[model samples]
Target: MRILLIEDDPRLNEALCCALRQEGYEVDACLNGQEGLYYMETGTADLVLLDRMLPGLSGEELLQTRRKAGDTTPVLMLTAMGTLADRVTGLDLGADDYLVKPFAMEELMARIRSLSRRGGGFHVDSGELAWGDLTLAELSCQLRGPGGECTLSRRECGLLCALLRHPRQTLGRSQLLLSVWGPDTEVEDGNLDNYIFFLRKRLKSLNSRAAIQTVRGVGYRLTMQSEDSL
Candidate 1:
């Protein structure tokens, strides 16, 4: 899961980022509302943890602007103003959920999971994804075949998940870099290609015939063109 956390407080931001990563979610954070809006305009985030009070543009305004622009990425408003009217206004502004500040990490995770899964809490695993003999367990994040289970590192899992999500679509190198390593990481350039190589080797071990096709002067694609769209 990729999440954008728009919080200006350094302490809260640090806590949220650390905790969410521990739970295996990729997070990009911004210290101000303008930065948050900038990230939203530039990156693909599965959800947004927006603080209601922010400089430059308030969270309410940000949500309104995103809705006005037809961006439906889920937004969960996190604020200190815990009141019925506050919650009501947040929902009116198109927030998917509202969490008061000084909230429990477990509650935040639960809410985040609920928002990502649309309230039922199921992780929404799709039907089996196959690239030749290589198969991905969408729900389990496993790479396996008739032989047995093949282990995948954290980065490898992230890469394969992304490729499977957008099968046959050429994901740009920068996009992959940003997704695998969060915006704040100091990863050297070309790290994405290295991870791709690792992912390809793991796939091969599972007899995957799907190629991570590289486009000269561009990026890579998981070429499973023969398969139907999910």
Candidate 2:
């Protein structure tokens, strides 16, 4: 699973990132609410770990903005404010769960699992995400089609998931980069191009009807059109 972590304290942020990574999750760590919001708006993270007190934009303001924009990615608010009213306010503002500071990692993991099972994030019940005849198994990163099935690397899986979520709609390069590689990563345009090439090869190998079409200077889209049309 991919998680966006927003914590201002340098030590806590680093520790959380390490722990989350050790748990086998892809994590994007941000020091402030503004950066966190930038990542959240990419519609990529499966979960968000938001700190209530942030440097630039407060966590409450960020959460409110996200909810107002209709982003349903599950948020677990982490804060030092342990009062009942604080918890109530966080929940009322759209947090799916609340964790007071100095909490155990075990409890945090438990809450994450619960939120994932509750299906508020990027999770799907069938363990598969489908577009046209293509179906990708989340756990194994396996892409199956009429011809056969092939396992994809983590990055490939992330890229394809973003496309499948909005099939046929153009996804900008920057959006794809942020979503797949984690926000604010310094990935090159050629890197994305290479991945696109790899994905096309996988589709061709499967003899799938779907294709990833490039939009010249714009970006790319998933389509069920013949290659000749491109």
Candidate 3:
């Protein structure tokens, strides 16, 4: 399926693009709402992962604009937590789903899967990921951890998906950046740091005993922790 990722954070954009590509899915991405809308206008994306607080043309406005123009493509809105009210407003504006920031990749994948199942897009996922109580249905893009549920932004989903595939191997910052973001992109290393912070927060919230360990001065690890009850 062709996926459009609309996120401003360079680290997030790069990681998501790279990870999705590795999964063999056709993906096109944008840094802001304007670029995202332009792509949507082209009718090239099967689904869109749109950030709510964008620079120009916020995600909410973008979705409403598309719908006003009679475009009904599936859209998943991304916002930081504490913005559930914002999500409801966005949904009223025409978004199909909403995901908060500090979310797991698996959760993001699950939401996409849910969208795909409804939209009937051609999916190309491997479905081989599991971390602690979390499970990733790669081909389906769904995540589950105990009873708590969360959907991932495309960027967050790809970051975690890549880490899950790598397990305890210490992926270097450069390697991770290249792997997640295509090598041709002009993103900087600082971007990777931001995503690591985002992923860590998400995992901690889902399960405090979960493992997405950072190797000082290096990259990270997404290993299974046995002590947790969940």
Candidate 4:
């Protein structure tokens, strides 16, 4: 899972980032709320750990702005204010959970796991993306199929997510490229083809009937093939 850690204290930020990384999570650490806001705007992070007191923008202001802009990524507010009123205010401003400072790392990790399972605000109802018998766990980057389960690389996960979001539809090359790679990325067409090849191989290994079929001049479509066809 990708996490954004926004904390002003240098020691605390470094410690938290190191701990989270050790636990196998990709973390982006920032010292203030402005940087945190910028990262949040990218819509890349799965969860955010925001400190209440900040330099550029306060944590409350940052959360309010994100909520107003319709960014629904799960947020866990971290602060020294442990009073009832403070917790109420944070929750009212759209924070999914709140944690006070001087907390145990174990408890923090537990909360993160719980929040990830609950998914982000956009996917609170269904955390796992599914099609047919194939299931993709976004937070863990694990794909489960008829054969078994396997972990997917970052690019592979992104590609599968894009295709799964519009299953059975032919997503054009440009659209897939922009979604998998970034809009500003200058990548060769062959790179996308390579990933497609990898995904097909992965599906076969998983014994999945789902196939990634390429259109003559268009992009690709994900569909379930009949037993006779396979």
Model 2: lDDT of residue 112: 79
Per-residue lDDT tens digits for candidate 1, residues 169-210, read: 887776665555644456776777788888877765655556
Residue-level lDDT of model 4, residues 122-166, one tens digit each, is 233344789987999865779999999999987787788778877
Best by lDDT: 2
Give the clashing residue pairs of candidate 2, or none: none
For 7-45, candidate 2 gives per-residue lDDT tens digits of 999977876786567445899999999999999999889
Instruction: List residue ranges in candidate 4 displaced over 4 A.
Output: 121-230
Worst 10 residues of 1 by lDDT: 119-128
Question: What TM-score does candidate 1 reach?
Answer: 0.53
Error at 20, model 4, angstroms: 0.1
- What is the lDDT of every predicted structure here? 0.75, 0.84, 0.74, 0.83
Q: Say which prediction, candidate 1 or candidate 2, comes out ahead on TM-score.
A: 2
* Number of the top TM-score candidate: 3
Q: What's model 4's TM-score?
A: 0.53
* Candidate 4 accuracy as lDDT: 0.83
> For model 1, what is the error of residue 191's alpha carbon versus the real structure, in angstroms, after optimal superposition?
42
TM per candidate = 0.53, 0.54, 0.56, 0.53
Q: How far is each candidate from the true structure, as Cα RMSD in Å?
A: 10.6, 11.3, 9.7, 12.2
RMSD of 3: 9.7
